[model samples]
Target: MSEQPHPPKREIFDVPAMTNTDNKGFLRPVDEYRQLPYGLYMSRPADHPRFHHLESWLLPALGLRANIFHFTPDHRSGQRLYLDVGRFTGPDADGRWYSVDWYLDLVDVPGTELELLDVDELFTAHAAGLLTLDEAVEATEIAVRTLRGAAAAGDIQSWLDAQVGGRMPWLDRPVAR
Candidate 1:
């Protein structure tokens, strides 16, 4: 396969400052941020056509950032969850979080059924030297592990609850219609 153009995907979560810097470097105000033992939680308004807001949990231990996009009624796609496989880290000295996306994503639809997306993008990015060998391998492993765990537990939420020892904050919020 030929190498395709792939931009670096990284995000900055500055909870103390209540700001989020998107991959494109646009700064957006955060509505809320909560630091949990397992990860950092962020809820922010999105200036997008399809979704007005989003809530995400950056679970570094699982190498997954789980997202709930509060989609507009016209754009509801029946996707329950979106998981990004990536290297996530945080709170170095400035109490900020970071994420480096690995070009692979998992979309949960209807229920626990997950459809992996962007495998070709991953391979193409790897070929283009955008991701190191270790990162590519790690992304693949995380995606596989998440799928297996969710399948075994009967749902993604169950698997995540087991991992974090309880339900996440996003679980309590009703999905915006």
Candidate 2:
């Protein structure tokens, strides 16, 4: 078997001279960063072919980072939300945020399905000694709990709304024409 890859690291710095770095180490200019009660919210332009922009909320309480990809019309994937299970922290003395992906993800299609992804990647990483047993277990638990909560609440949006006390910023944004 091929060796499993290490998890990606993300960082967001508040300094005007600095830019948010993505998993690929690309520095992307952040349009905004809002420190919320539950977590940190970031919006930035994506330098990718599929999506023109990205908005994400790093919810530490949920152990998940939720993303909304502002895809170009021709590249729509029908995915309403993309969630990454991970360890997130931030805004220390310098007001910087950090995230380490745990190799698990959720693809929410809304009213259709909440697909769990990268189970094999999670297991492979654990086997390759890239993640501790405790970390792997925690990541699994977070994914399961999120699925269950979303199911019980009728949808991911409702589940997130309940957790954050209201609608997320992305939810209120006007649809692109």
Cα lDDT of model 2 by residue, 1-177, tens digit? 376577555565553444687777777788877777899888888878999998889999999999999899999989888999999887678778888899899999966869999898899888888889999999999999999999999989789989999776773563242
Candidate with maximal TM-score: 1
Task: Give the residue spans of candidate 2 off by over 4 A.
Answer: 1-3, 13-18, 174-177
Q: What is the Cα-based lDDT of residue 23 in candidate 2? A: 73
lDDT by residue (tens digit), candidate 1, 66-122: 999989999999988899999899877999999999999999886548889999898
Q: Which predicted model would earn the best lDDT?
A: 1
Worst 10 residues of 2 by lDDT: 168-177
Clashes of each: 0, 0
Worst 10 residues of 1 by lDDT: 168-177
**Residue 33 shift from truth in candidate 1, angstroms:** 0.3
lDDT of each: 0.89, 0.84
TM-score of every candidate = 0.94, 0.91
By how many angstroms RMSD does model 2 differ from the true structure? 3.1
